[model samples]
Target: MSFFNLFTQKSSSKISDKKLKEMLESSTPPLLIDVRTPEEYSRGHISKSKNIPVQNFEDSIKKMGLKLDSPIVVYCQSGMRASQASKILNKLGFEEIYNLGGIGNWSYGLKR
Candidate 1:
């Protein structure tokens, strides 16, 4: 089965950045999603991460070109936006969704 297949199953695992980093280092790295506004995302984000911006998430998911089954790791400037985005993704039927809480907790650093 491919990574996309994972989304078909239900995921109950919620992870932290330290655990998320470990997965990135040892396992398949989930899709790191930044759910802040575009301006906030442009300011800085985890390296190689994609910006979806919570305000436009429902309409922009397809445009974001994210793999449906890919393990999703979402984050925001604080934690609120990402929390909202997480619920949205879940309703969209994405399995294996994980929220990284917020950018403030990212220690590996960010990029513009």
Candidate 2:
């Protein structure tokens, strides 16, 4: 691997929408976050997914009152932003972070 790759590694953890739903239904659910624009989130988003725009991800997470090791699942309009957010979460000491990809990939419906 390149030297750059060693410093900027992406997380490998990802989950499908069905798995996300199942996890949500569990007694201990992961912290679901929508890393999309506020306007996009206002249009529609996954139920119980908090809108934390990717631009200010760190600040948003700090205000969420979550622990450093909280199980967090992040998504966006597409998978790109979620991937970036997952990297940030990993660096911030979040032990369990999962990228749920895009809301478009969600087959279980959304909340408007």
Candidate 3:
């Protein structure tokens, strides 16, 4: 692989839309988190995703009592906050963390 390719390789935490769709359709789906403001989430969000603003990420996550090995998928308005939340999850010892980038990337129907 080229040097640039090595540096630009996608992280394992990155999940494609197709893969995400499959996961959501499966019997056991990952926990989907929208790391945006409550107001933003209230306007529109991916169906079944829980609103957990990145600012209150840790506290909310801790309160949920999720197991460390639980699969979690995070997203934001434009991907940045999702990335931030992924890092926090990693630091908090979460084993399966997937970043679904931005909500804009989701092709499925959303809930308002």
Off by over 4 Å in 2: 1-12
Q: Please, what are the lDDT tens digits per residue for candidate 2 over residues 1-112? A: 4566567655649898889999999999988999999999999999999889999998878777788667899999889999989988877667688998888888988899
Question: Per-residue lDDT of 11-73 in model 3, one digit per residue for the tens?
Answer: 338998889999998999999999999999999998889999999999999999999788999
Each prediction's whole-model lDDT (CA): 0.79, 0.86, 0.88
lDDT of 3 at 51: 92
List, residue by residue over 1-112, the lDDT tens digit for candidate 1.
4577556655435577789888777657778788888898888888868888888888888666767677888888878888888888877777678887879888988887
Write down the TM-score for model 1.
0.78
Candidate 3 yields a Cα-based lDDT of 0.88
Better of 1 and 3 by TM-score: 3
TM-score list, all predictions = 0.78, 0.86, 0.87
Clashes of 3: 0
Off by over 4 Å in 3: 1-12
Clash count for each candidate, listed in order shown = 0, 0, 0
